[model samples]
Each structure stands twice: as structure tokens, then as C-alpha cells.
Target: MDKLLSLCMIVRNEEKVLARCLDSVQGFVDEIIVVDTGSTDGTKEIAGRYTDHVYDFTWINDFAVAKNEAVRRATSKWILVLDADEYLDPSEKNDLRSFLTGLDAGQPLGISVPIYNCVESVTSGKFIESSAIRLFSNLPTVYFDRPIHEQVVYRDGELPLRSYPLSIFHTGYLDTVRKEKEKSSRNLNIFKDLKGLEEYDYFTLGNEHAILKDYKKALYYYERALTKKTESMTIFPYCRYQIVLVLIEMKRYKEALQYIEDNLKRWPQYPDYYSMKASVYVNLGFEEEAIELYTTALTKADAPAGKDKRFWLITPSLGSHIPLMNLAKLHQKAHDFQKTVYYLSKLVTMNVNDHLVLFQLLNILVPNESVASVLNFLGKIFDFGRADHLVKLLHVSLLLGNKELCEHFHQACVKQNIEMLAQQQLLYALVFNEPDRFERHLPEAGSGSSTGPLNKLIFLAAIVWKREDFSSYLSPSQDESDPSLELLQSMFATLFHPEEVGVDLPFDVNYISTLLIDLFKMGYYDSYDWLIQQYPQYYFILANILGDYFYQNNHLQLAVDYYSLLLDQKQLSGPGYYHLALLYLYQGETAEGLQFLRSAIELCSHESHWYIRYLKHSPATEEKKEIARQYRDRFYPYVQINVVEQLLKGQA
Candidate 1:
């Protein structure tokens, strides 16, 4: 006789995905046991289609109790526990059947199947695989443990377990599903009643709070877990990792570093601790130290024969790939271009589908190559990914003066039927600077209006062309073109007569910056002045572009006004301060200029060549020279100020 298997599950309002889970195992399982705990939806009706063993259970707010109740009704020799959102792959059905049939009839055993928890990220989707003992012999002693995040265990029987390559795809963690379920809040409420039961329970509480972004609360519970004196804790490493992560989230770098240092002797082989230490070092501006720590992490992670060869779920990839990425960033920060490329190339091989990495590679490589080489490289590497990413590639193609490549990409866009109206508008208005091309992609006359990517692009193009009839093209009548265009009419109203429009609506700083740059390029001073005059608060974006534009065109007073407004906005750090300082010096405001110049050097000493040069030329008393020396010493350790000083002297 063939061995029988019963599918046992407890569900509530899982009507949406019930059919899918049931159909995957309908042919294999002998009996289907679904215990509904008060479902108002078509869950019961759907379960009825699968099997007659559907039973209703009372709500106890205890997952283990409900799960155990479902399993108790199973009559088969073997039991398979599953959730509503989880299912075995259809392709693995035959293999699962074969494995179950081949099991020893005399043995009391279970199989640890891999559960691939699928989650969709901004760019792509990936699975986080974990092991769970879902299949077991139907013994009365074998049952689930805990109220939430429950696990399968046996009471008195020694259920020997073996691993299987079989996987169950889990969708409960998906953002779309989780928003409706709010599982973390539910779990948190359930955990409130079950606190102080075990050290592992404290860890789960920390995880729940961490998901809710309550890092302070999370840290408190994590510390509580650490305080628990257990002889041998399996989750101790994970607990340490979580504590460090929470500290980092709070930006308590000093506390985090001290914790890592204190624990280094105890958990020497854990790569994530080292990774956390490197992060703290980076935040503190200790670049060299960060690089060394990141390197050490990579070494430990890749070691073939290490004493502690265990991997934990909390930071599965920290030891493997994140270290390399961090190392790459540190090299990039230190301006070590070749080393940056080397690490990034390694990352590319590891994550071939990473468009951001591919884009970064192009950014670094394109500047050093000729137009033909860049075009050839783009053609060889550019695979159709996100539309926004492909748009950026087109912009890069235009920057390299490869019109043919741009046209090729345009043809590809048309072939793929990808709607990239914003990109096409940018290509015309910004890259090609052709009014004809800009006008070609405008929305049809009868199409209704709303604020969207395409409509925003249209507004940008209209301003660039200085089209007299642009308002007619952007009719306020709500006919029907783009849904997101309604909020942007205030921005567009200020286009022709900015002084007349109020600054109640918010406009994208980036979009405004691009528009300001274009208007400055085209010498449309009236329109540019109107825009800045209307929205005085968002002057940071306008001021930077206008200040530089006017400074380059020798409009010193106007440039000073724009730059001074930027300074007034508390934006006087790094490049903004440096440029404002130079402008003040040009206008002969020596005292005011020197203060701004000092701020620039203090913020980023690596780019302090000109500031140092100006200080050297100015009349400097002993006290002023000492102050200058202090500023230079504080910010310019990595910068070759002496080399810059010598070069300036030689020029003089």
C-alpha cells in the first residue's frame, strides 16, 4: 500500500491565494485539512473545492494552538504543514512524491525543506532561503511550538531530520501583501503576552520592533536578550548583529564602535561586526581605517578554513558581497579610480543584473574613452532594464556626442514600445537643443491635462523654446492626458509671469535646477528672474545654478546676490561656501570673503588649493596666520597643500 500524506493548514480570509496553494498539492496529498478560524470571505467556499476535511476553529490568538488543532484531524501516516501564502513549486511535485514514497516505513523522521521567502525590491526581486521542518510522520507527540513565528517540534519521540533540496515559495513578506496583513503589528501584540518566556522570544520582539523602525525600543529588548544567561545560545551572534544595526540606525556611532570593540574578542569570526565597525569609521571620516576594516571583513568572509563557519539569517550576505561593495565605495571616496573599478567589476560579476553597478561602470569608463569606444561599449553591455535607467543611458550617449547611438536607442525605444516621453523631451530640449525635436513629442491637442513625468517634461521644453502658444498646448481644461499633471500647473503658471503666481505649491528642486540652467544657457534673463523672484524659499536650487551661470558670464553683483541668498539658507558648506568666498573676494570684500573661505577649508580640505592660495596672498598678521594654519591642519591632512603652495608660488 502507498504511504498516505495529509495537508494541514490554518487560515483566515485567505480567499485570494487559496486556490493557488491548494492546486499545487491537490494531486499528491490524500487528505486536505483546512481549519478556518473565522474567515468572512470566500475562503470556506474555495476550501470546499479542494477537500471535504475543511473545519472551523475558534480564535485563540495563538498560532501554535490553531496549527496543532488542524494537524490533530489528519488521519494519514504523514503530515505536511503549510500556510495560505506558501506553496511548493509545481515542478517539484514529482520529486516530493518520490521522496515521500522512498521514506523508510519504520523510521520516525522529518524533512527540513528550504523555504524561499520572496520579496520585491525597488529594482529587482530576490529570495531569502531558510530551512523549516514542514514534513513529518503523524505522531501525537509531534507538534508546533510558540504563539508566533512558531516552529515544528516533537514532545517525546526522536524525529531524526534530513535536509532536502525541495523549496516552498513564500509570498507573505511581499510589500503588497504585508500592507494588508500588518503582520508585524499583529505579531507585536501577540508577543506582548508571551514575553520573558525565553531568550529567543526577546530576539523576536527586537525583530518586530526593528521592522516598525522603533530602534530605541529594539535596542532595549536586544539588551534584555543579551542579559539572559544561557549556557549555549544559538542566536547570540544574531543578537549582537541586531544591536549593532540598531545603533547604526540611531547614528550613535561612538556607542556602536565601543560595542564592536568590546565584543571583538568574544565574536572574532563574525564578519558583520567588522562591517558595522567599518561603517562607523566611514561616518567619523576615518576613511583609511574604514578601508582596512572592510578589507579584513572580506578576508574573513572568504577564508576557506575558519573556526567559526556558521552563517546566520539576520546577515546572510554581509559576509559575502556587502564587504566588497563597501570596499569599492571607500576606494571611490579616496579617489582611487583604478581600485574602485576593480572592486566594482568584481561586484558586476557577482550581481550581473545590477543596473546601478552597470551605470556606475559606464560613468567611470566613459570619461576616459573616445566617442566611438563609448558607443561600442554601450552597445555591447546595455541590456533592456528599467525604462528610467535606459533613459539615463540615452542621456549618456548624447553627452559623448554620439548622435547615431542616441538614434539607435530611440529606435530601440520605439521597437520595445516603451513610453519615455520625458527622456525624449530631455534629449531634445537639453541635449540636442532643437525646438523642432522638442515640439515633435508634445501631447495630442485634445488630450486632457494633469501633472505627470511627460507633462513636466513638456513644461520644461516649453520654457526652453520660449513658445508663445505654450499655454494653449497646456490647456487647464481637465480633458485627460496624465494624472500627475494637476499639481504642477502652479509651477507652469509662474513660467510666463512668475511674479503673479503664489509659491503655495511645491516643485521638484531637480526639475527647477535643470530649467534654470537651460534658461541661463539660452540668455532668457527675464523668465529666469521671474522664477527666482516668485519662489524665494527654494533659492538653494536656483541660486547655485544662477550664481555659477552669472559668475561665468561676469555678472558679479547678481552672482553675489544669488550666492549670498544660498548662504542665508544655511547652505554655506563645501562648494557653495568656496564659490561664495571667491565672489566676495572678487568684489573686494576682504573680511567677509575670508570668513567664507575659512568655512570652505574646514568643510572639505581636499579641495582647498585656491582657498589656501588666497589666504597666502592676503595681508596676514601673526594671529591670522595661526588661525589659517589651524584650519588647514584640521581639514587638509589627506590633501597635498604643500604641493599646492609651491605651485601657487611658482605661478607668482
Candidate 2:
């Protein structure tokens, strides 16, 4: 009488966890039938410790077939199917031992066991228990089918399988959700190749699609799966979630509200349902309502049992950062700086690596003269290697006019060979009213040859405009034909006047222009005049900068002069005319501004239509009444205003 139970398992590369799993059940089961389906790890060697029934089977695409093969190889009266990442807790092992002891003398079928799935928490790095069903009967009366989400199908002609309280601890799908996603994708491709995939196949495909973030396709498949008339409400709620997610992605917030309301009507305790509702409210700019929903989600998070009630469901993970960050932004947008600072501070505590949170914190905290507090908080939580944090610290120091702190951070950046640090250092020098300090580092701007062209431009822009005199660096042969010169030209072209180019440049040209414009806008008249006279061909690049600087700094007369110079230039182009129109309107010369705007409309043949609309609606020009009529009659005939209107609406 072979008084034994054979443990069956199908495995691949499970070397990292196979030993632990086998050890957990080795005492309860007599013979372990470890079925290897092309495992390239030390899994076979590790499996040898518990049993000698290890055998190899060629992998077919169908997992059900592989599992069935494993069941057939067992020689004992009872068989237990397990995975390489699954284990039996001590209590579960004792339960199984007791069940086996009391097994009917002639019993051939097995019992279903409860499974507790544990996932590693992304925030705390701890494991939380979820639930599933892993234990099942080994008798031919019960079989599994389906290519991907294989279900245990019981044959119609046998005693009903018994379910026990014995629970399996599943670590297989823990941090490996990403890997399971890949497996699902592979299964999807296989199902797609088949002649006709059933409704179940569509559900599995939808699950894979949802995991991959292809929400529209996921919704399509889910809707199709729903149409199959399945009675399983378990899959229905998940499908609804996927549909809501798709609507969210599509930015159909108003439509998604109905779905959320319907979902809550049925499953009121679902945490993710609340999270989705909150997300929709956030998109619709209902910040107060969104916050309320999120608060409600926090209360209901722990209501669900099993796999759905993990840390991700209860406490916010990295996924929840966006909503919290948005709420902070909303406070900032509403001019509630204190609330903005408070929320940003909370976000920084959650994850210090989030540069956006650090930026927002600096933006709010520095304006309120709370730089020291922010710096101290950041120092406590963040490691020093984060370049973005260092940059933000330097920015905050500059904002507070603390040259000593700025210099300290600048040195740290230099020591770390962070190229952006050089740019930040230059900005720090300029902001603190110390141009000489920036000039001292000018020669070393391009010293790091490996630094990208964009970084070098930032360095050069800082030095050239910040220095007291522009004529000192003049050379007859400035290597104007060099690739670096072209890059510089392209950078300026896209930055100040994007209408001149058909496509946007791949670097931060606006930042470089901003730095240069700031120097001229701060009453550096000599430098601005000298650069304009020397680089007349590049004058259009300086026009917007000059106009913006003067307009912002209350030097409207100087802004008028720059705008006039831009209008006089033959290479002023379409955007140049628009800027000139804006400046004239700003200077109370509405009629002249309207004429310049009309000229811009004529030049709009090669420019984006949005620029034309901008010119038409510009209050800075006096000719809007006439230009509006002219725009309707003359330019509207050639321009695709409908498409341009849509693009304008999108921006608004």
C-alpha cells in the first residue's frame, strides 16, 4: 500500500524561489512530482532535495495540458498541484495532513484549497495577503481548459470535489505582475492566431490589454466579452473598471461620471471604483469633489477582502501621486500658497525622488521666504546624488538672494560633474546681481566636451548675455559655419520664432532665450544695443525676448523700440510681425498694431494658423475691428481655419 501523496508542479526559471516553495510542502507530501518544462535554472537540482519524481515535459502553448500531464505522472492516491513560487503555511500544511489522514480508504478525487496571494508593496516593500483558489482535485473527473486563464472544469459524472480551509501562500504573482503581463501578451498573440477565439479568450485578451495600458482596445474586448452573456459578476466589475479607465484615458470625464455612479451603485465598497471617480472629477477641474472622493476611497479601502485589499488599494502608491500633485497645483493656481506648500511638502515626504514635487515645493516655499525649512526637509529625506533636487536647492537659494548657499550647491553640482549644474550656477550668479561670478566660469562652459549641445547652449547663453560687455568676445572668424553654430541658430530660430520652422527643436531653446532676454530686460541697454548692432541678422531672435522683458519689467517705451526694430528688419518673418503688433498694442498704438497684425496675416502662408488668430484677438493693437473683418474676408479663404480652430481650442 503506497501511503503517499505526490506533489505536482510545472516550472520554468524558478531558481530564486523554488527551494523555499519545495521546503514548505516537503513534509506534508510523500513524493514530489516536479515536472520541468524547460527550466534553465537550478530548479531541477533544488527539486532533488524533496523528491525523486522530477521529470521533464515538452511545453505546449496550453498551460492546462501541461498541468494535466503533471497530474497523470503522479503514482499516489492523492495529488497536489503547486507552482514554483507557491508554498503552504504551517497551518495549511497541518490542515492538509489532517485531511489526508482522514481520507476515505478508496477516495480518488482531491479537494480544493484556498490560496492566499501576497504582493510586495511598492511603497513599503512589505507583503500583503490577497486571495485566490489554487487547490483542486487530481481525479480525471476534474480537468482544466483554456489557453491562458485556465479554469478548473469539473466533469459531470463524479462526486462533487470538496473544498478545504487549507490555504496556499502564492508569491508567484507577487512582484512579477509585469512578467505575468508578458505571459498574457504572448497568450493573446496565440489566441489572435486562432481561427475563432471564444468569449473567454476575449476576456483574457482584455485583461492583458488593460495591464499594458492599451485601454481603448481593452474596452473593446471587454465590451465584446460582456456581450458573450457570461453570468460571472466577478469579471463584470473588473470589465466595468476597464471601461471607466478607457473613458478616463480618452478624457471623456463627463461620460465616465455615469459609469462610476453605476459601479458604486452595485459595488459601493470598491476602493478602485472610488479612485476612478476621483480621477474623473480631477480631470473635469472639480478639485474639491475629487479630493472628497479620494478621502472617501481612503475610508473604504480596507473593506475588500482577499487579493483586492493590498497596500495599493488602501494607501496610495506612486500611481496616487498625480492626484495629490494635481490638488497641490490647484491650490497654487487658486493663489492659496499656504495650502500649496502644505500639500507639496506632504508629497515630498512620500517620495523624495519625485522632482516635480520638489519643484512645486520650491516654487511655493521660496516665494513665501520658507526656503530654509524646505531645504532642511529635503536634506533629511533625499540623498545628495539627485541632480534635480540640487538644482532646485540652488534655484531656491537664488530666489532668497542667498549667494553663499547658491555657491555651496554650485560646487556640489560641479563636483558631481552634473552639466546642468553649470547652467544653474550661471542662473544663480545672474539672479543674485553678480554677473562677474558668472563670467569667471565662462571659459569652462564647453570644457566638458562630452556634455550635450543643449547643455553647452545653456552655459554659453548665461555667459554671453550676463557679462558686462558683448564686444569683448567679438571675432572676425567666429566659425559661423560650424555644426555648433547651426545648432545654436536652430535653437534660437525655434525658441523665439517657432513660425520660422516647420517643426519644433528637440532641446530647451526657450530656457536659453529666457536667460538672454532677462539680461536685456533688466536695463542692460548697452549689451542689448551692442548685440543688436553686431548680430543684426539674428535680430528677430532677440525681438520677442526684448518685447517680453520690457513688457514684464514696465519699460513699455523700450519694448516699443525693440518691436519697431523687429518690424523694420526684412527677415522679421510672420512671428516677428505678431510680436511687433503685440508691442504696439501694449504701447497704446492700436492702429499701428492692427497694421502689423494684418502684415502678419499676409505672412501666415508659411506660419501656423494659431499665430494668425493670436494676432487677430491681440488687445495690444488698435486695428482689431478692421483686422477681424479683413481676417474674415482675405486670410480665411486660404487658411484651414476649422482645423486651426480645433488646434486653438485644444490649447485653450
Candidate 3:
């Protein structure tokens, strides 16, 4: 007898994962029809191992044509079409087999099967499922049309169809190995050729362009598709969603907001619509509105209990944590210590991994009584085997003047054999004004070790500055004849005036300057001034550091002059421009500050790292706020600035 169910597939170069898919459905389906369109890989050879009904067809520009051809070759009563990257779970296969047996007894014209799109290897792999029609009768009553998004065309009479509970594990969208852009590019060319085919065809073309990351072209096509007016109102929202996504990508948040408002007015039941709306508010620096929408979305997820009957409807499998995380991030950015802690506590209650959330919380929370509380909280949750987290925790503890906590974390780090932890521990000792602890750790550094003499000398300088013992350390080091004396002199100059170090260690220049500031803040100005005079080359560094110190201390004009001198130095570049821009902001020269800001932005645009930091730390004034906004909107468009706004407001 003929088979009751047939598995139809069209593939090219899918040899890597095709066997796994075929093996998944082997026991459930009775017939397998594999169609190949010029695959040079061993895909055809592999397909022969599974079935005898393998056939080749000429490559066509239309996917629907290829799929329809594959479906026509099925010799069974029912056809189930799937991609090579898709598979059937064992339980789902059993469900399908049972459904196939029932269909054989009384088969419908078509059936809709559920498809699950799963994102794996993120925080955790979980399936997000949706439904689509993939199974249908092979009778002449049902046919497919269009090159893409082919719909089931029924005869003018009442057609029989059923929604099956069986699900297909769809990996096609999640499979990142396949070059999606190449596929989209190929489809886009075909779409352009068939521009006037139909309104639905134009929408498909727009989707194809959107997938290819050609937002401008995608927007043009989607607008043209909307003009057709032949498509249903329900279909209009999907096109609008795509258009809004493109607008967001282009940093056209205002236009995107309008599209979202129109979409929500028509279909507020769509959960994704609310999520997109929240995203727009985030882009436009409107955090309160975004949070309101997110809270509404969360309420919709849960079934209504009390008299609040006006909540929006939400779909299943859409988790509330996605928006909650965004909200927490907003609070953190605004430096609202209490609210940041509150959100983090809520996140932990939701069964989130507390370690991750707590680490982020520590980064945002101001160092104080809460710092000790957070450190203790972290110790209770995660193991110290992770050196990075332990080191970070140690840094926070030291900053908060929690010596006991710092010592405890330092012991944990020592047990973990973390090299960087030792350096951090030394710095911590200096910061806390503990000379005995610093002396004890000083001898631990050796010549060949990663923690070497140079780092040790820097640490000692900081410790001496803290303890007012610089005279003892620098007494013998003033003699110019000894090699160690020159080393000491250069170290003193570099530590206090890093601009003297020149181009050999460009990155290290900032490191030295930061150490000098710490020493100065600890009241070691006498040694700082001596080093500045001895190493005249470091005059620029001293000037810049003093400029920043004065600015922070509210001596704005003096800071401006020092920064100007640093900028005027010959061959000055990176640090020079950055410091000058900051000084201009302090002096209320907003236009000059922006000019320097733009110069810094251009200089660092090609740098792989630190570019974001460079842009973020540059001061913004009311006169230059528009310039700052434009730069942020252009370069870092993905960041949600309303998050920053919400944070600032919460802090206020």
C-alpha cells in the first residue's frame, strides 16, 4: 500500500547538519523526497543513504517554486515540507505519527503545525515557539503561489483544515553558520526583478532587503508595499513592524515612535508591539514611558485576578525578564544606588543567577556602607574559583575602606593563584593607608615575575606618599651617577608626570598619571613638585594632572590654564586633546570643547577599544548638548539613552 505521510525537503550545501534532521524523522514518516539544486557538497551522496526518491531540479530564483516542485513529487496522501536545518523531537515525532494515522482515516485539506525558534548558548537555551502551516493535502484543490511567503490557495468552496498540536523544531532561523546576508542578497535581486508581481510579493521583497541590512532600500520597498492597499489590515502591522525596526536601526526614533503608536492603536494585543514601543522610548531618552509600557506588558503576561480589567492582552512564552532587565539597567545607569539595589533584589527573586546581577550592581552602587553589604552578599552566592569576580569584589571592598573584607577577599584571591589580584591587593593596601600591609606585600614581587620591580616601585611610591615617608625613599635616589638612581628619578617623573614618558608606552602614560593623582590626593604634593622640576619633559603631564585636580577642587580658571599648556606641548596628540576638551568644558568654552571632542572622536573611531569610553567621558554643556546628542545617535545608536535619563532622574 502507498505511504500515509511523506517528508519533502529542498536543500543545497546542507551536508553538515542534514543527516541529523533526516535521522530525527526517519521512524515517523513513510516516504522521503529529497530535492537538490546543484549542491557541490556531499549532500546528494548523503541523501542517497536515507531515500531512493532523490531528484534534481534546475535552480530557480523563487523559493516557492522550488518548494512546490518538491511537494509535487511526494507520493503519499499528506505532505510535510521542512528545511535541512530543521528537526523533529522524539515526542513531537510521535505526536506527528499519531496525527498522520488519524489523517489517513479522515484527512483534511491542510493542517497548521507549530514551529519553535530556539536561541541556544545564551544565558540558557530555551525554546520560543510559534505556529505556522507546514502540512497539507496533495489534492488538486490546494495550490501555492508567489516566489516568497507562498500562501495556501484554496478552491472557492469551503476548505477543510485543522490546527495540529505537533511541533517542528525549526533551526533554519537560528542556524548562524549559514550566510544569511548572501541568501538575502540573492533573494533581493530576484525580488527587484519581480517588483510589480503583487502587493504580497513587494512585502516579501522588503523583508528580504531588511534581512540583508539594507534599511534604506527596505524602507523604500515597505512604503511602496503599503501604497498597494490591496493587503489586509492585519497584514499591514507586520510590514509596519519591519519598517519600525529599520527606522530604529537608522536612529530615526521619532518616526519609529509614530509607527509604533499607529500599530498599538490598531493591535494592542501584540506583546512584541509593546516591546518595540518600549525600545523606541528608550532611544528617545524617555525612560518613564518605557517603564510604564514594560510594566503594562508584564501585567498582560499574567492572567487578570482583581477588578483591574483594563490590562492589555499578552501572549504565552514571552518572558517578562527581558523588559525587567532593561529597567534595572536604566536605574543602574542613572546612579540611583537604592533603586538599582531594589531592581537587583527583584531580579534575584525571579530565580535569575544572583552572581551576574550582583556583579553589575556592585559596579553601579556608590562605595559606602552598602558596598560591604553587597560584598558579603556576593560571597554567600558565588564561589571564589572565578578570579575576575573575586578581584573586582576586592577592589570594591578596598575602595569602601572595609579592610577586613579586603583582607578576606585577598586571601581568597591568593588561594586562586590570580596574578592580577596580588597587584590589586598592593594598591588596596596603599589606598587604605596601611604601610605595614604594603611593606609585607612589597617583597613578594620578583625580577622575572609578572609582578616585577617596576610595579613594585610604583606601589612603593604610592605607599610612601600615603605614609609621608617619601623623604626616606628618595634620599639616596637623588644621585645621578648610579644606574638605580636614574631608574628612580625616571620612575618618580613618570609616576607624577606621565607626559614625560613619551610614545614608548602611550597606554601606560594614563596609568602613571592616575597613580600620581592618587598620591597627590593622599597629600604628597612636595614629592610631586620635586619630580615635576627634575623631569621638565613631564611638565605637560603635571600641568594636565593639576588641571584636573583644580577643576575637581573648583579652581576652574587655573585648571583651564594648565590644560592649555598641556595642549600647547609639541607633538601632543591623544591625551592632549582629551585633557584640553575637558578643560574647555570647565572654562565654559562650549564650542571649543566640542571642536576638541569631535577631534577625539575622529581620532579614536578606528580604535578597537576605548572609543566608547572616550565619547562618554567628554563633558556636555547646554550649548553643546545637541552636538553630544548627534554624535551619540550616530555612533552608539544601539545604546538606550533613556536608561541614562531615568537613572539621572532617579538619582535626583
Model number with the top TM-score: 1
Model 3: residues >4 Å from true position, as ranges? 45-52, 104-108, 114-131, 140-143, 154-160, 169-181, 227-234, 304-321, 336-652
Name the Cα RMSD for model 3: 13.2
Better of 2 and 3 by lDDT: 3
Give the least accurate 10-residue stretch of model 2, judged by summed lDDT.
467-476
lDDT for each residue of candidate 2 in 421-530, tens digit (9 for 90 to 100): 45455556565556676666655644544334334334344344542242232222233332354455454444345566664343433544554554453334464454
Question: If ranked by TM-score, best first, what sequence of candidates would result?
Answer: 1, 3, 2
Alpha-carbon lDDT, every model:
0.68, 0.59, 0.61
**TM-score for model 2?**
0.49
Number of clashing pairs, model 3? 1
TM-score for every candidate vs. truth?
A: 0.67, 0.49, 0.55
> Ten residues in a row with the worst lDDT in model 3?
310-319
Clashes of each: 9, 4, 1
**Can you write out model 3's per-residue Cα lDDT over 442-475, one digit (the tens) per residue?**
5553322443333534545553654333323333
True-vs-predicted CA distance for residue 22, candidate 2, Å: 8.7
Q: What local lDDT score does residue 249 receive in model 2, on the 0 to 100 scale?
A: 80
Winning candidate number (lDDT): 1
List of clashing residue pairs for candidate 2: 131-307, 585-620, 590-621, 590-622
**Winner of 1 and 3 under TM-score:** 1
